[model samples]
Target: MAPATISTPRYLLDQAKRKLTPTPNTIPGMGAVDKRLQEKEWDQFVFAEPPAGSDLKPIMGDSGVPIIGHMIEIFRRGPDYILERYRREGPVYYAESPALSSVLALGPDATQAVFSNRNKDYSQRAWDPVIGPFFEGGLMLLDFEEHMFHRRIMQEAFTRTRLAGYVPHVDSVATKVLANDWVANDPRFLFFPSIKELTLDIASEVFMGHPAGTDKELVTTVNHAFTTTTRAGNAIVRKPVPPLKWWRGIQARKTLENYFLSRIDEKRRSESTDMFSVLCHSADEDGQTFTDAQIVSHMIFLMMAAHDTSTSTMTTMAYHLAANPEWQDRLREESERIGDGPLDIDSLDKLENYDLVINESLRMMTPLPFNFRQAIRDTDLLGYFIPAGTNVVTWPSINHRLPELWTDPEKFDPERFAEPRSEHKKHRYAFAPFGGGAHKCIGMVFGQLEIKTVMHRLLRQYRLELPRPGYQPRYDYGGMPVPIDGMPIVLRPLR
Candidate 1:
């Protein structure tokens, strides 16, 4: 059976909402969202301009299967499926999913177009299907001026002073996690779950200034909420089907809202150094502040993006280093040269070799595999016409591995990023692990600091090793690409 499609998008979207609408017990204090969902109608927009001229081509590609579309095939084949197709189909091509037909903008050329979305052709709104319900009003979901306005105020939360404050929390937490949480030399210590836990703990501490296990289990609830919401990023079924990922995501959204809203008053009253308090007090020069909605939404997205990417990055660095001990030795040697002391902004930069390895790991794994945008108006990706409302998929994930751009694209080579051998500089958008243009990750600095802080502690203290030296990560690329088995590995103690 095909996944349900909406001919009347507004009406069908409403019906889908009704199916997933929260129950009182399931959603807690989300009666407001329920009210909005029940009463509000989608203000559908259509352009005044006529269709593209006969000269320009329609989007090139394939919409696989009926109903289910490319959903199943994507899961089976992973991103390489699209990569191979891109090689055969050129930089611009079309592909269909259960929800919408989209233009696949591969390689650096089309990728630069979408990321440098100048005329407001692409939108973050298309993500509403995947992330809207969970992270509504999130910075990533807003478009045009509204996105800029919110980003401006939210910028206060990630300022240099704020980031400096966050480093101590990052360093302290990394120490505590390695000491209390990780058992060194465990033959089967899983890297994915362990790193996930560490990053979540780091997220709770560094972002919210809250304890991971304490606060009456605040962190635990937050952890559950992040897991449920992220797991539903591409759930096949949209309905609140019993025992399902989509359903849990809805419930998690409600919990997150309640918890975040409850903290607003307290955060405003006190002067805390955490990002949460910073956001609560954050305002533009015109005295504009995030409504309660924007604060919570931004926090939820920032927390998850930070947690997920940092975890993926650390795990990849660990996996790759374990596989290549010489590279591991090279990095550890630099870490030692920089001293086994706490790293500040200057010291973090001084660990040039460490940065290269981290950069290479990000390139190889490409944490946020694909960044999505929908066309708001007809747009051209390298002369290929993408009609309005088509979901535009751009791949940094696939771009990193393109043979035309990177030398020996599949080899685990960190020196490609080092000194004169800077292969990532071969193309402007060729190595966009953190995305590009105005929509580039706001937390890139913080994410880098967090990754370096954790790895610095671990790398110096241990000679890490994976149980299966040649074990390849089988990525489950739903939202972010994560290893299905949680990346099993064991740590080898240096002392």
Candidate 2:
């Protein structure tokens, strides 16, 4: 049975026939958006045309409909919307959505242009309005010198030794939690939420140094806090109005702040191997440690990034393996070759098939789909004039699927990542699921180790298949790309 086929939604196919007349009050609290200006064009959202006397081409495209712009199309249509635009326009184009009017940079060269940012023309400040309120002062939101300063300090926590130390804890958590929380031979196990819970538990142990039993009530609250704060990034109404996503996230941020602040002293005083304790003790070359606020912010961001991203990636891996059973069997055989024992970093490296599958899974459905930045000064991307203050969007999701860069780009063949067909090596930024340049994900190594450990345990324990033959799940990209159906699977024990 084949994975479900991709189809463009009817609305998009029929958009040409629809009336262009604006609808009044389609989205609540959109008074701030320039509805009239939105009628001009998406490129015109920033400017009617390129700056006078600049030879660079003007970004092309309309902002979609007024106020909400392309928000509905983006979330509802998933990557299809972006792919359609990529096909219509070249690498550089314009798009508009609530709170974001920007140029979409596609392909490896465009991604490198923005990420390399040689002249320091781009700033991470663009993330401020999106995730900064909740993840404030976290490493991703810092810019230039300050970013280098904190990244250097934070490097202490993710050192090779620290990562190796964290692996045993990850293995143990995966072994215990999967065995304890999951029931094998079940025909309807919800893979997404189930793995979400499992990864959260893993994070609690490996990142916080707390066993699964550590303050269950507090841990649960913290977990929910991380979730809400992340989901708040997509809130249509950006204000902290009661009962809305933004307000709940603001409240969740407070919950996280108090929880971390209360325990910072203990973490600093203790000799613990968890990330929280490590960050407390990690210092830059000059021996400057993070202040209490910096520690709290970093901890919140790391915890959220660790669990949520791993959950998405692991779920995607499970889906691909389930959909393509041959790959599952191959990976299982590779895992089985390792024999039964406590897995370590060296053992993790031996699973070549797993690495290929993981890379392909990441290419197929990257957990963090978009890399965002703000142009701090006028710049040209591939000769397209991008003015200062323009919000810039680049899609790793799009990059991974560019037909020019990838062979049969949409297919599930993981071998493209293996051997002589090393398609990801096509360009420097050709396959950046972890992002690139100075701000590449610091915990990427740890993240991959955690995923492999949990996944290796599962592959060793059971055969994963979709709930029914040819069953395919639809993804909701509201926050990260997650299966809207929770991705139910039937697990048959290998024994």
Candidate 3:
């Protein structure tokens, strides 16, 4: 498909690129400023008077409560609050958020404009207000040319051959971790925490190639770091006050930086198949490799994104299987038909039912419910004038549950994604769990492989059941969607 015709944010893009292109000694300190000030600057830029004879539609919505805006409501109600407004207003709705008054673009058309970003009018730095505080200098936070430049160098690590090689490692980690660590016989098992740990261990072993059962303390710290960062991204107290989430997140980032930076010299000299090794060595034709700081920065962001999204997805999938035993039985039957445990890339493709279930689960409980961007220039999104610096958000989480898009939007139905009827394909951005366009997730394939491998082992060994019938997981939208109750499930050995 042809990429959208996008325009670069010339001055700002240059400034961002310079920030990321750090000097050898000064690398650690670059891009460390809290973005609250940047957000205020954007408010001024966005809400300023338009040029003469501007025919743009003035943004409309509740200004929200005083200084805090509508964020409290958004935090309390999650995407439902936004969806309720989208229904009342239209696809192009507006609201005053903590960052500023912005537009919420619903449905496929808005998603395409934002995701396709043909005009290069949107800035990925929109994540800066939240994610940048914890994940600055990461590729996801970079915009346009700078993003593409780093992405090109990083692409060498994720080639088809390299990904194929990683599968065995993923399978190995999944098997060892699940079999050894998850033997709880209690009728009520802590599914979220258990799955989180398992996925983190897998991330550690597969992505970093850490020795099995080694570095327990380091892993624990890393796990804590990820949680702290997630909480920081959604923290109500956005300032770095002591004893607050922001302060905790800073400490965690410091811990993570020291660890990753310390390993750079070692990883660069050594040769291995792990992602760290690949990143350490991989470079572009110009021989441009990620600097030590860049490697550590990217690792912190990517690893957190990798493990947390998977945990949320697996938790939701388990909930669905627990609630609907028929689907669970079908999944078990599908596993049996495929012949045995520890599925690889070749055999995994044959597990059609497994794919169906994963798809439906993602649809029912989308991992990344929403994505945001800031307009870098005056742009028109589906006939609505979005001024420069306006915080524009697209709601894929709620979009997946739109009545117009799905036959029974709220119901769990795997067949919707199967056979001649591929519901997600109905719209280009209809089921964008991993996002769409140029900045779509780079680890998309690797995540799927990891999920399948983990599920393959899990289905062979355990018959999963919720502790109680008719149980529904309550998701906390603080970060990604996670079960607030820890998603209790009972696992009985199928063997």
Best by TM-score: 2
Best by lDDT: 2
Q: What TM-score would you give candidate 3 relative to the actual structure?
A: 0.87
Q: What lDDT does model 1 reach?
A: 0.76
**Residue 455, candidate 2: C-alpha displacement in angstroms:** 0.8
110-149, model 1: which lDDT tens digit per residue? 8888998878788886677777788887777777889899
Query: Each model's TM-score?
Result: 0.88, 0.90, 0.87
- Residue range with the least summed lDDT across 10 consecutive positions in model 2: 1-10
Given candidate 3, what's the lDDT at residue 7?
24
lDDT of 2 at 214: 73
Please give the range of 10 consecutive residues that has the lowest summed lDDT in model 3: 13-22
lDDT of candidate 2 vs native? 0.82
Q: Candidate 3: give its CA RMSD in angstroms.
A: 10.3
Q: Give the TM-score of candidate 1.
A: 0.88
Q: In candidate 3, residue 240 scores what lDDT?
A: 82
